[model samples]
Target: MQTAQRNSLRLLQWMMVASLALPLGLFVFASAVSWVSIRETADREIEHSLDVAHEHALKVFETIDRSLSEMAEIIRDVPDADIVAREQMLHLRLKRLVTSLPQVKSAWIFDAKGHALVNSLVVPAPEIDFSDRDYFKAHVDADIGTYIGEALTPRPPYQGAPFFGVSRRRPSEDGSFAGVLQASVFPEYFESYYARIGREPGSYFALGRADGTVLARFPIIDRDIRLDRNGPIAKLVAANPMAGLITVTSPTDGIERRLGYRRLAEYPIYVGAGLETSAIRARWLSTMSQHLIFGAPATALLFALLGLALRRTRHLHFEAERRQQAEEALKHGQRLEALGRLTGGVAHDFNNLLTVIRASVDLLRRPDLAEARRLRYIDAISDTVTRAAKLTGQLLAFARRQALKPEVFDVSRSVQMLSEMISTLVGPRIEIVILGSEEPCFVNADASQFETAIINIAVNARDAMEGRGRLTMAVGMAASLPNAAPLPQHPYGYVAVSVADTGSGIPPDQLERIFEPFFTTKQAGHGTGLGLSQVFGFAKQSGGEVAVASEVGKGSIFTLYLPRTAGSGRSRQPATDAAAIDGSGTSVLVVEDNAEVGRFTTDALAELGYAAKLVGNATHALEELATGAERFDAVFTDVVMPGMSGIELAQEIRRLHPELPVVLTSGYSHVLSEHGSHGFELLQKPYSIEQLSRVLHRIARRDVGQEAASASS
Candidate 1:
């Protein structure tokens, strides 16, 4: 009896001890968790605050920018608005804006001499001289654009004080400088907007220039203060061009905060948001506290009960192993997908290089080379380079990074051309059929990529057939697909090109994954698995779709639906005046920023028997034209250069001298729209000596004929 009583008492004592210890441990854990939770919550709140402020600041900035741009555009179009009339109209516009927006502090105009013509402030100051200001000069001399000044000013006489200004040059139709159109708005206008943006009480908000000139701040509420680029916030500004959250220690508070920055390119400003670290930690802490608080005691009881009621179930371990394997497989698939995209981009650039080399070599293989063994050797050198270029192009096309020269071409013609190559490619084992629409279906696709895709499919089909099969090409329209959007159509229409193969069909399970990058069922050495992926990428990039249908016992069909058009019939025409080239006495002005390129161009022009004068940039070119008044027959310039683009220079020149002919050259031709105003001709870059000579001759002849006709009239 004594022994049993002693054991029972010991057990009871142990239970009491555990009960006391549990709460003490819970207290420590809960407190730690709560601290973390509170900190995280605070951090999140701060971030939210900052984000809201940044967004609000951006909204205000955009509104101001848009309003000013509209105002400038309106002023430019107002025909009746001479100096006096313009002052009156501007006052009316300013009053309306101030009343509607409630943020615009003032709007004013500066005469050519920088004296205020009109002020929109409530108690407007008398005209002040701003001629000495660099911004004033910048606006006056801008030539083609508005000049935006950094945020700084004395508080305005208007209800809303302290303003930044944007000034644009106003010119008369007769080519005389009219005056400067200036729009000024209060910094508080932005700060107020920033303050009201959703954010935690302690969140920081700032708006600044790309160079870190602080324009507005919410908490600090400072105007005309610039942030040091070497500071923490400035570092965040420098790094966060695309805008995402980052963690940084606050220089002001010495506490870590998550920072987010958004660049407002339209306004050329930066919006920054900062959230406290404590805020993010708060949520984590709260959940963790709740989990531990209730879970500990419940878990202890459950453990005790589970131990008593435990029963083993078979196959649990096997199921777990299978799940782990599947997870690993999924991870590997994702990695492959990323790698495929990277490889595709690399391949695209390689193709363009190959195209250039191929063209160069083809041009070099002249009978004139037969006169000397030296000439033959040079031709061979060109051929070798061309072959290597072709290989690089093949790789880049597979990778999908090559810049595409897309055009509407017949799908049937593409198939027919591929058929000619298929006999040798498939070793006479595969029979190729070209089934095309009688109506001539067309698609906006790069012809080179299209050919590559067909070849890859043929290779795959050959492999599936084990070196023997029938490949049927069927061209038609795809009735709407489940997930596919309607293909974009030009004046003509759209069609679907289907390549079907009779061979060992793909397994049902692998069918869905067949188009996935680097996925293959072929023997290890037979394929790279990028063939189908390349086809899919090319189709997608070309604004088309690819579809697949297959059965294990039957065959497989891949449909490439593409937009079509009636043949443009405007076939690629070779230069007609190539044989009759004469650039004698043709005065040409060449505007290029690169010193080496400019020198090479002038030297090349001189060699081609033309007079060439090279200027450093568009600004210098414009200045030269204005001051020298040199009557050049043509102005040849690079489209993309520092200061002013070739397009802008062309526009300015046409305004000044309408009779001058322009030929713009660039590596990138997509920006031709910017040159549309002057109807200038475009020449793609990396031109050879012959191409330059031919273009110059053509321009010179055209100009001479026009001048001659005008003189006779």
Candidate 2:
């Protein structure tokens, strides 16, 4: 009790010090603030103006861009119109665009020879040639995308002012460059918009090219606005093209202004909007002149007032600080408590899985076990391993380190195949209905992981229904997903797999955090909270997204969106019975650092009628190959080992033994990224005997074919 009293007294003393510090600090700050310069005010104003102007510029550019793109699309898809009729329709449309948006000087459609096929303004269009124009020449030679060229002036009476051509090259039916669909936008359009950016007199706003060519400027001093590449503003813009503030003296007026500038991300143009620093300083000085008079008096009064207030609030301050500390301690405890709960939950789930495995193994140890009972134990063990693999897969996915073995397959077909399995898993009480679109829904991703994600979602829905409701899996095409990341068929289509359930839906508070790792709404000891997280991570890593919508007491729909693929027709191959395939004394060198694993590989190879040799590392394998290359027909290597990686060993083998086949195996390897298996055969770990037989057969066939070709040569 005496120790508690002493601690309380010390806390009170510290609270008193803190309470006094605030008022003293405020007094010192108030006194010192007058001495600090006001230069940043000008920069702040300039930055605000630049940001606003840049936004407006993007909108304007987008408007013009969309207009041109639409026009081009229309002309490109003109659907069997005669040359004369198409030209007339194209002329009218272009004219409408130019009139609607005053910024568009003209839109032109021209053939490969630069002959003007149609123009927006020049009716009975003159036989004008744009052959000399860089924008046209660029498309004619080789244009990968839209080209923004330097300013060009009309030869005759057409808008004496210069215009920059933003052109997209037209492709022929044969996929060859055919023509150019050009939008010539006037500089005056940008200049007019920029004029409103500066409220102060002599202030400026301008747009320049990435290559330091001034395109347009406000307060039109003259037409001769182009400067040398080494000019101050040009140099500044070139050095920091994305965004920054730089003081530059106007070449026309010789007035240095604080400028805020940004380079347009979509286009090769830079925009700068600014106000004169001198004008800003004058305005600030005028406003602050009155405030300066009361500084000393105000500071003195404030210090005295705070001293009295602190004295009166001493007890309150001590109580409040003590209460705050207690609240913070409570929150920290709650967080730690929450973490402990999570740990306990994960540990309990894993322990249950391990118990399943352990019990299954013990059952398998009984010599008197019947064949059917033994099979049941094996299935249970396999199921537990699968569950454990899923847990770790989710962990790896959350860390963004799970390697993908992507192949294109139809999502609709995969769903159809999984329907029966899902029905059996969910039990008879839950009705599984699959609603597939008539159109093909294809995706490029790891088929196994994709199947796992769908199963996880399906299982989640099943649980939500408490094993007694309808679960509907709807497959179709989606235009946009919930996230901002770009996918395979961006802005066009995506393969969507939605699992919806008529269950007691989740509350809004819990719904938002469903995708977070180890976040579950299930009762403790029932879930590891990694199911939905795996779904989330797999979708994201495959360049897609997962979206969930739930209504309380009604139902919930969980959708996984994957990028659309053109269906590489790479279906999952059904493994044949391993016992049926004869390895026929084909020599296989088993490379694994782990003795148990290496022994297992060799035993399996021997069981399949293949003569096998065991090597501990890449060094031994390389030495074996060096001494007798003909003795080994293939190398079955583990991906991650001590000295040299399997991929590196594969590279070495490819260099030395061009004719020999190398098969790499890994459940998950840091070194075996998707690219590592490009030209080499891969046997995923936990592979069935049938899958092993299937890969070996394929390798043998490939070897025979290579040998035949070499003999023919």
Candidate 3:
């Protein structure tokens, strides 16, 4: 009896200890998790602010570049004497230009001797010699393209805020440096824009030269501050010149911050945004304190109710699982948000293009328009249409719905041929290295799309490396993919084309989403974010897959795996410029649900010398065909309709009229993308009149050939 009592007492003591520790441990773990989440949130906010600063900086510099280009054009042919004679008139023009751009403080044209010829700041410009100025000196000897000078206050009597000079060297007719066209860009303009966007306290923005000279900054400082050449931020920029994120202490203020920075593509400028580490830590501390306030009481209550501790622990586990589920739901919502952004971006671009087209059309309708003006309007419309088509094509490529013409080609040869072109595209700073296996790796895919994919990947690598890095393109064969299922044609193996870059790698959070449409790490206006997505889609649509492996601060490698095919592979024949054949005396049956489209189709066919009959829907089309009142040479129908889809209609027509040819058309069709055109010729929407005429003519000619063969038999 004594032994049993001792054992029971020990058991109760141990149970009590576990009960107290369990809740305390859970509280600590939850607090740590909360702290991490808060830090990540702060980091993302800082990164977004950096994106805004980058975009603003690019716009500011681009406007300056445009203004300089205009000035250069204005004086391209004029002699120095003419410029002196037209000084007053040019001064007014320059003033107007500067006034239109809020960021530009003034404009000046300096002759080769550094004498001010014309300036926006004063009429009958003062005979000020700017030979001592850094911008003038920099361009006096060499043509360094565009030179963006450090911040400097204007000569005493005429100043508001310090400004930087963005100048381009003007060339003489003999290709020698003739003068400099300079624009004074106000740093306060950028500072004001930054202040508006960065409303959070302890946040800062800086615009600096690649060589560490500060051009503009928010939280304005009185003294000039230049970054140390060997400092953490400068080293980071040297290592990864395009863009990156870092956590460091600010040398000027001694405050630790999490900073994100991007370097401009065409200029020696860098934009950075950072959040004070103290502020982030304070937020984390506040959140943890609230959790502790709530958790402490609950922990004590559990300790008091030791008998029910086991049940309470189980409930806490259930809550944790529920929280995980909620987090997953939040991730789904984020994906939806991304999709919304993609749609909005697409809509915005299309709206702008449409606006241009509408204005051009309105102008063309004017009765008093000159021939030159009319031709310009027509050309504008044509260019807009072409751009619109390219946009839609990119979208289709991302969706994996583009109509591709597949052919068997040697991947190794293609890479070899593209190496020179890639070198040219990426510039001299990037070294292009090609590695190919002795054995030819053949694959069946679209030749043009394959080339495009390679170029896109190379361009992406260039940006990631900031135009200076080694890009290795390797072609070989692989038996299996890294994270993909075995291909249906596994017996033949796969052609693996890998592109490796020594550049800043993608972050862990962004690695999985690199292929998402409209997702990019590049600064705005420098990328459309469709390149990798296009690569992804083209690979998948070609019965292959694209895989990426990246390590932050190291580099990245993107590999495209295509199913291998036997044979040496045939060379792609050059496309001939075929003329549209006349469609005289041929009859076409047009099946379209939309009234306006049907009318347009009939009119276009009539203009092309084809007799066409239009019907509202597939059912009516079938009825008209059943009547046999009018013999049809060919059937042209849309793929998508209200009832009995065009694909189904085509199938029915083929079943009844075994001798007739059918052509299908659509801007986009899920059926066509997924199941193909059911062995019929397909014409894409927005096709030219010549294309329409040719397709109809081909079918009519085929029908005639068939009839003649039957008669001869």
Candidate 4:
């Protein structure tokens, strides 16, 4: 028994030792992997910085080379005598050239004797001798084509900042060096550009000659510094002259860096971009410290848990199961609570609308109601019903199921037209600025809904600003969304309408919930909170999206992005003369699922001088049409119904009748929202009598015109 006990004790000790060793090994391996990843990411960042610097250098050099070539061509045929004689004219030309190029400071034409023939700085060429200048001397003996000389300070008469000369050897007829045409390029130009591109802390950009002559360095050193020919960078260049990566200490600053260097393809110049090794290492260390901070504790906790688990496996399992059950119960309760809030909000708004309608109807029912009072009550009821419809429409919009009549229209022009209305809506205290591209940006969407969305956003902006601030609405083109996701099938790209305001701005926590229905930050009665929700839903339903950005103290900007349409199709302007829309007793087939609505529609149609017949569904309507009992001018149908939807029915009627016009009407149809009106006129639900009459009359007139044309043909 003693021998067996001893062996078991030894086995337990070995197991514990193995467990500890395994975790330690894993921690070390993970640390190694993280280090490698961090280094690689740092290297990639450095390389990217190098690429930006290289491209900027190329652009600057190309511009300079082109300018030099143009100047060379202008003076190519002119003799030295003419160049001296027409000094003022040549100087003016050079001045114009320099003025055009922001990078080039000045231009100078030197004779073979190194006398300044013409200078852009002064009309009569300055009595300055360029014989001593490096650029002039470089071109004196040999035709070096184009020479980029080292940086030089301006001499006495010619005064400005330190600038490097880019010169071309002016050849004589015998192929001998005649003179030099030099353009003074300010080092500050390249340095300023370098400052913009290399923005990382401890980052550096250097423009240098192939022979270690430093022309410019960003972070502008107090004194000029050149690279040593025997340095690591020079050795790296000697090995790979075109481009390379180097890890070395700066001879000037003595700070070590990981650098990426590139040589210009044509020019004998190099552009180097680097981040201090300390920064890179610090980044790596910071990342590693984070891993250590989390991983060490986690590993330690895992070890403690594993040890405890070995001792009480069954107990731990029971505890885990209990915790999981508790979590699930908590989540379920939260979901139910959220559902209650949503349903409660919707019910409250609808009940308020119903109460107004009920009170209006009761007042209208008074036995001795005054004519004005009765009209006022009736108008109140109408307005209440419209509000109710709008509330439901907003809900449907949030659900992305609102039926929309999409048409191609210019977003810029729409904003411009609505600027006056927006100004009034926001109030006098708020300054409204309308900005848009000179070129029209077209988008395919419901124009009315688009206007509503803008107004909704503007109202929110007005409230956020407390009615005093600047509200700017800008429309422009965007290639992709903020998330960098590519658009689909829209070769014309996307149109972005951004509404910005100087307001109190939204909290980060509230931003995520801003689009949720009835989620408002305002006090009671201040807002419905469905404004942004409507904008969100409308954007999504239109194959677009809305995004917002905000800071607590700064303001907020809401941008709606819609697919751009290449066609320049503007929204049809409302007919100014009502007489143009003539019904003229045109026969119509009305397809409605509701009995009351169908009866009301038919009566309204007849009252508007259109002979009408009603059917309960598309099947009955189609059957009636198939019978050919009467020639119908158009088919007005509801979109959503039991069996054979209005859109499908319209397609069927179009196929069979070919000449009949189909007008679709809907309150909210998922099909209609997802797929548009299918080339049919659409009348949204809750439309007024005037709106209904106008639609029917327009279709009727169109049909009559088509019939007349057919008969004539």
Which candidate achieves the best TM-score against the true structure?
Answer: 2
lDDT of 2 by residue, 1-713 (tens): 99999999998898678666755565466434632444665667678878887887787778877876886677674432343356776788888888777777888877778877788875666777887887788787675576777888886656567888888877456666667878887888888777766667547788877776677887675665666678877787678768988888888778888788898878887788887777766766665554555454565688999999988799789999999999999999988986786677568768989999999999899889999999999999888877777676776675556778788888888998999889988889998889998987878888988888888888888888999999999998888777654533464378889999999998999988787767877886666788887887788778788889899889899988988865357677754444446788878888999898888778887898888899999999999999998888788898888889888999999899888889888877765543547578988676666677667766864458768899999
Best by lDDT: 3
- Local accuracy by lDDT, each model: 0.68, 0.79, 0.86, 0.85
Superposed on all Cα atoms, model 1 deviates from the true structure by an RMSD in Å of: 14.9
- Expressed as tens digits, the lDDT of each residue in 106-199 for candidate 1 is 6766667877666565323355687765446776654656455776555333233556676667655766666676677566776666666635
How displaced is residue 163 in candidate 1, in Å? 46
lDDT (tens digit, per residue) of candidate 4 on 641-706: 999999999999889887777889988787777777888898988877678777776666456787
Root-mean-square deviation (CA) per prediction:
14.9, 12.4, 29.1, 17.4
Candidate 1 — which residues are off by over 4 angstroms?
1-373, 380-408, 417-430, 444-469, 485-493, 501-538, 547-558, 565-582, 594-597, 627-630, 646-661, 668-682, 696-713
TM-score of model 2 vs. true structure = 0.57
Q: How does candidate 1 fare on TM-score?
A: 0.42
Which residue runs does candidate 3 get wrong by more than 4 Å?
1-321, 416-424, 427-433, 465-470, 485-489, 502-509, 550-555, 576-579, 701-713
Q: Which residue pairs of candidate 3 clash?
A: none
Count of clashes, each model:
27, 0, 0, 0
Provide the lowest-lDDT 10-residue window in model 1.
569-578
Model 4: runs farther than 4 Å from truth? Answer: 1-327, 438-440, 484-491, 571-584, 701-713
